[model samples]
Target: MEAKFQIFLILLAVLAGTALLARRINVAPAILLMLAGIALAFVPGMPTVELPPELVLLVVLPPLIYSASVAMSWREFKSNLRPIILLALGCVIFTAFAVAAATHYLIGLPWAVGFLLGAIVAPPDVVAPLAIARKLGMPRRILVVLEGEGLANDATALILYRFTAAAITTGLFSLPKATGTFAVIVVCEIVFGVAVGWLSLRARHHARDPQVEITLSLITPYLAFWIPEHFGGSGVIATVACGLYISWNGPLLISSATRLQGIFFWDLIIFLVEGLLFLLTGFQMRLLFEKSKAFPLEDILIATALVAIIVVVARFAWVYPATYLPRLISKRIRERDPAPNWRTVFVISFTGVRGAVSLAAALALPLALPSGEAFPHRDMILFVAFGVIFITLVGMGSGLPLVARWLDITRDGRDEHRAEHEAEIAARREVLAAALQSLDAITDDRRLSDEVVKLLRARHESRTNQLPDSLDPDAYDVSAAGTALTRELIAAERKFIHVLLRDGKITDETRRRIERDLDLEEASLSNREFRKIAL
Candidate 1:
């Protein structure tokens, strides 16, 4: 237990350090963390850490999915639902078949085993690619489609995986029955997820205490996930639905303190979860390497290369046609949504980086059949799955930025960003106007004192004055300069407050209250500055 605790601490340290270095070098932390884990695994005296499949599937996944769902804009998710489905459902199934065919014919694996490998490697990882894509400022729609697909694709892949595994174990298969069961799972999980979200929101609202609300927030995903999963469903869609429900409804019902504290808490939790996940994924290389001695090295290499190539080519083949063929066939579809730029489509196709979920799925494969015979090529399947993850994460993950640059997708997003900023500015002005009108009505109804009315009006006016007149580059430069000066002033104020405490002039509690206000002001300034530069 002590040794295990020590190893965990080491992993956390490496995670934090590698993440910082990755940020400094402008690379995705997932890429660096994986590489770091691999290197650490080979170090003499480094204890081998095997990532438990159940740990990832049952424990890690729910929170990651739920948090992402909560963060997603429900409106944007809805608008891009078609492409998301096409990629999540259609692309995943197509890729699985493509891999199964390629492996069965070329590599001489059984049909079920080949399909199992395909399902394991099919879904592009949600974390690594999005981190890189967001940094590259790929158009909003492409990110949405990618993130949406990532969120939901696992359910499709995992369900297929379960069915294939069961068929291999029992030697029985039924397409129609499986199809009906899949539909039922999807429908049931959706309803259950939404129900969970509604209950979670109401519970949090009633609690009112930030700590308790945050605790309930932490429990939300597991409740949404575990119940459906216990009954043989994937639990992914349920968690997603629960999160989306909370996201869309919780704004009005949730207390402000909970929102603020929950943001930091969730952000930290996700950071550690994602970083450790990638690192552990890298550590699995050592185990796979030790297991590789069981098979001819040449055969393992050939199979790995074969499966990796097939998954990559399969995505390109599926994505291009799936993107444009609908428009070519249906005028109604064409009229409603025009064909996206080819470059955007290419970026999406190029981002099919497999992640840890694939590894977990592979590791979760049963060790033996019911009759006690070894599972067919189980070790080889694990090898190929990890190989696919490494090849995609290290290969495609690294190349995504260059691909976006070559295709000039970031350049195309400039106008979209500018327009978005314009909309934001317009909304800000409109909201302030509404607030002022409400203030006037309240003042009249309450017969408020002149002093209170004047103070409220002045506060609102100051907030209005802070808005930039326009998104002109010069205006942004001036705002940036002013913000920098404001930060320096705040820093000086903080220093003076410390001195006051040192001199016994202010109590610790009084110092904290003053520091909190300064911190909020500084945070607001930083946020405004980021918005200006992000355009």
Candidate 2:
């Protein structure tokens, strides 16, 4: 028990170091974490960490999916639903079949085994590329489309994976039955996921404690995933649906305190889990190398290189036609949605970097079939899966920022800020108008004093006037300037407090209390400023 606990701490410490290093170097943490894990694998006294397939599927995946789902923009997702569906469902199926065909012909794997490999790598992992994408200042629409595809594609890929693995195990295949089952699983998962989200939201509304509500938020995703999956449905889809449903209704249903706390908690959870998962993927290298020793190293390299190229090319092939074909065929689509430029399409196609889902699916493969023999080409599949992840994640992710710069597709925040400011101004005016009407009604009552009514009306009118008008760009500039100045003042106060602490002018307790107040002010300033410019 002591040794096990020590090993866990060591892994965490390594993860922390790698994360900090990645940030300092401006590389995505996932790439560094994987590299760190690989280096650690050869170190003396390093414990081998093996994650069982069932655990990865059932335990590791649910919360990650939920956190992503809750943070996703429902409005943006719906707006790009058509292309998202094409990439998620259509592209996923197409990639699986394409890769399967390539594997069967080039690598000479059996059709069922080849398809299994396809299914494993089909869904691109959103975590690594998204972190890089945000830093690269990629367009919001492209980010939304990518996120939606990642969220939705896993279900499709995993379903195909299950059917292919089953075919391999049973030595039988049925296309019609498989198609019917896939449809049923998708529909059932969505229905159950929505129910979980709705009930969780309702529960949150009635809860008095913020802590309890946060706890419920943690459990909601797992419940969403487990319930549907228990009945032979895709847990991945269920978790995403639950997250989307709750996120869409969050503003109205959740308290401000609960929302803020939940965001912090989930963000931390995701960071730790995501970093740990990537690092663990690296740790699997020794095992993978051991398993592949029977095959010629040159042959394995050829297979890995071939599959990686195929997956990359397949995404480009699917993205262009899928993106433009709809607008070409449908007048309604053309009118409703303007086609994106070739640059945007190229970015989307190039940035299909695979991550945890692919690794998890590959690791989750059974050690043996039902016939009690070793799973055919399992070693080769695992090797190739990792190859694809490394190539795509490190290779594509590293180049994405450069591509964004070259294409001049980086977001400037002007459009987003303008729209947000307009909405804020409208809301401010509405509430102030309502306040004035209430003051008038109170002034008419016999119990209300003229002095109180006059004071209330003056306050409301002043506030209404202070709000920036939509037509006056100068008002927005002034408001933003004031917020920025306030932030500077807050920073000055923080510096003074630190100096006081450094000089021992105040006790640690006193310094902490003063700093807390300063922190709150800074936080408020940040929130206001973020509304104006933050991504």
Candidate 3:
């Protein structure tokens, strides 16, 4: 127990330190975490950390999937739904088959087992590379397509994996049966998830305290996963559906306070989980090689290289047609969306980084079959999956900025902000119009103060007149000034409270009460800053 505790502490410390260093140097933090883990493996007397396969699939995946879904833009996701489906489902299936053929021909694995290996590495993990892409200021449209693909591909790949494994174990392969089960799993999981999300939101409508609402938000995803999986449905699909449903309704149902708090909470959770996953990948890689030495080192390296190359090439093969074919076939699509240039498609094709999901699936493979025979090349599959993750995540993540520069893909920042400001200006005008009409209706009431009504109307009119026809940085500059003023005021209040305590001018209880109010004021200002930055 003591050793286990020590190991946990060591892992956490390394993860935290490496993550900070990565941020300082402006590289993907996951890359540094993996490197640190690899270095630690060579250190003398470092304790081994083992992650159970079930723990990852059951515990780690739900919140990551749910949090992402909650934050995703459903409108944008729907708009690009066709391309997303093509990449997420079609590309994943194609890649799996392509990898399977390579593995069977070159590595001499059976068809079912070869395909199982393919499914393990099929869905590209977007968590690491997506972060890097966002930092590089990639276009929003491309980011949406990439993020949407990551979310949907996992469910697709896992379903294929399960079917392939079943065939290997039982020697029964039926395309129709697999298709039927796949449909049932998706439909049932979505239905179950939607029902859970609706109930959770209804409960949230009555809750007043931010703490209570936050707790409910945390449990909602778990229940979403557990309920569906318990009834023979895909937990991943259920969790994602529940998250999307809640995300769509949360802005309306939740208070501003809850939204701010929940955002911070989930951000922290994802950071820690993602860091640990990369570290675990590094640790598992070292352990797998040591535990199983069945194949020659040269043979293992060759197989790993072959599999990694296949994964990258297969994506390129799929993405080009996926980008252009729809527009060619459907005039409606061509008329609605702009045609994507080859440069954009190239970036998308190259940035498919395999992440923790692939590692988890490989690790989760069963050790023995129904006939008590060992699963073929289980250890080799894990090693190959690790190689793919390492190659794609580190290679692509590091080189993406250079590629973007070479492609010369720059964002139209001015136009984007101009459009945003126009929308905001329009919304404010509508609200003021409504307020003026309401004030006119109540102007004759005896209970109302004429002076107060006049003051309110004048303020609204002044604000409306200040609105610009286009984006003006000066209009939003006031927020930064206000933020600075709030910070100075908070500092003064803290000092005054300390002085009061030192001089015994106020009771401890009184000081505490006053400090709490100051804290709330700071939180409100912080929330405003957060919203501004988001815009």
Candidate 4:
């Protein structure tokens, strides 16, 4: 128990240190964390740390999927539904088949075993590449599609994995029946997921207390996921459905306090989960290394290379056709959503970085059949899966920023961001105008005092005046400088507040209230500054 606790602490330290270094170097934390884990694994006298398959599949996945689903904009997700489905459902299946064919033909694995390997490595991980792409400011739609695909593709891959594994175990396979079951799972999970979301929201809304509401929010994903997964369905779809339903409906029902507290809570949870997950994924390198001695190094190398190359090539093969063929075939699609830039499509293809899910799925494979025979090529599958993850994450993840820069994708992204900022300013003005109108009505209806009315109007006016009229370079520079000065002023005020507290000029309760106000102001300033930099 002591050793286990020590290892956990070590992992947390590595996670935090690697993330900080990655940010400093402008690299994805996932990439660096994985590398750090691998390095630590091979260090002399470092105790072996095994990642439990159940821990990932049952424990880690639900919250990760739920958090991402909630973060996604339902409007954007719906608008891009067709492309998302193409990548999530169609592309995943296509990639799996492509892998199965390649491995069977090139490496002489049996059909079922090859397909199992395919399913294990099919879904692209959402964490690593998306991190790199967001920092590089890839186009918003591409991010949506990629993120949407990441949210749901695991279900497809896992289902395929189960079916293929069952076929190998029982020697029975039926494509038509499996297809029907797949359709049923998709439909049922969506309905079930939405139901879970609706219930969760109602529970939290009535709970009212921030602590209880946040606790319910944490419980939601597991409820949506575990039941379906227990009954042989991928919990991913259900969890995603639940999250989307909550995202679309929670604002009106949820208390502001809960929302504020929940954001920080979820953000912290996701950061730790993602960072530790990648690190542990890298730790598998040592285990795979020890297992590799049984097989010839040449065979493992050849198979890993073949599958890695096929996964990359296969994405390119499917993405180009899937992206454009619809536009060519249907005028409706073309008119409603014109063909995206070829470069955008190319980036999407290049970002098929396999992640921890693949490793987890491979690790979860059965050790033997019911007949007591060893599971075919189980160790080999683990090796290849890890190799593919390492290759795509390091190779594709590192190269993505360069590709985005070379394609000049960020130019359009910057324009879009500027437009968004402009829209935000306009919306602020409109809302303030509406508030002033409301104030006038309230003043007359309630017969408010002249003092109160004047104070409210001045507050609204002050807020309206804070919005910049333009996002031009000169305006941006002025805004930036003003914000910096404001922060320095706030820091000075904080120092004075501490001095007052030290002199016993204020009670602790009074000091806390003042500090809270200052904190809120600083937080708002930080948010604005982040947006300015993001733009």
On TM-score, the candidate that comes out on top is 1
> Mind giving the per-residue lDDT tens digits that candidate 4 earns over 1-535?
9988999999999898898899899999998999999999999999888889998999999999999999999999999999899998888899889899999998899988888999999999998888887888767888899999999999999999999999999999999999999999999999999999999999998888999999999999999999999999999999999989988998899998898889999999999999999999999999999999999999999999999998999999999999999999999999999998889899999999999999999999999999999999999999999999999999999999999989998887888877777887788789899999999888778978889988999998987766666787677777778788988999999899989999999988998999889888888777655255344
lDDT preference between candidates 2 and 4, better one: 4
lDDT of 1 at 81: 93
lDDT of 3 by residue, 91-165 (tens): 999999999999899878888887998999999988877888788767777788999998889889988998898
Ranking by lDDT: 1, 4, 2, 3
What C-alpha lDDT does candidate 2 achieve relative to the native structure?
A: 0.84
Q: Give the winner by lDDT.
A: 1
Model 1 scores what on Cα lDDT? 0.93
- Taking all chains together, the TM-score of candidate 2 against the true structure is 0.88
Name the better of 1 and 3 by TM-score: 1
TM-score of each: 0.99, 0.88, 0.89, 0.98
What digit string (tens of lDDT, one per residue) describes model 2 on residues 346-382?
A: 9899888888678778887888988799999988898
After aligning candidate 3 to the native by TM-score, how far in Å is the CA of 206 from where it should be?
2.9
Clashes of each: 0, 0, 0, 0
For candidate 2, the 10 contiguous residues with the lowest summed lDDT are 526-535
Predicted candidate 3, C-alpha RMSD = 3.4
lDDT (Cα, tens digit) per residue for candidate 1, span 226-307: 9999999999999999999998999999998898899999999999999999999999999999999999999999999999
**Candidate 2 stretches greater than 4 Å from native:** 411-518, 530-535
lDDT at 248, model 2: 96
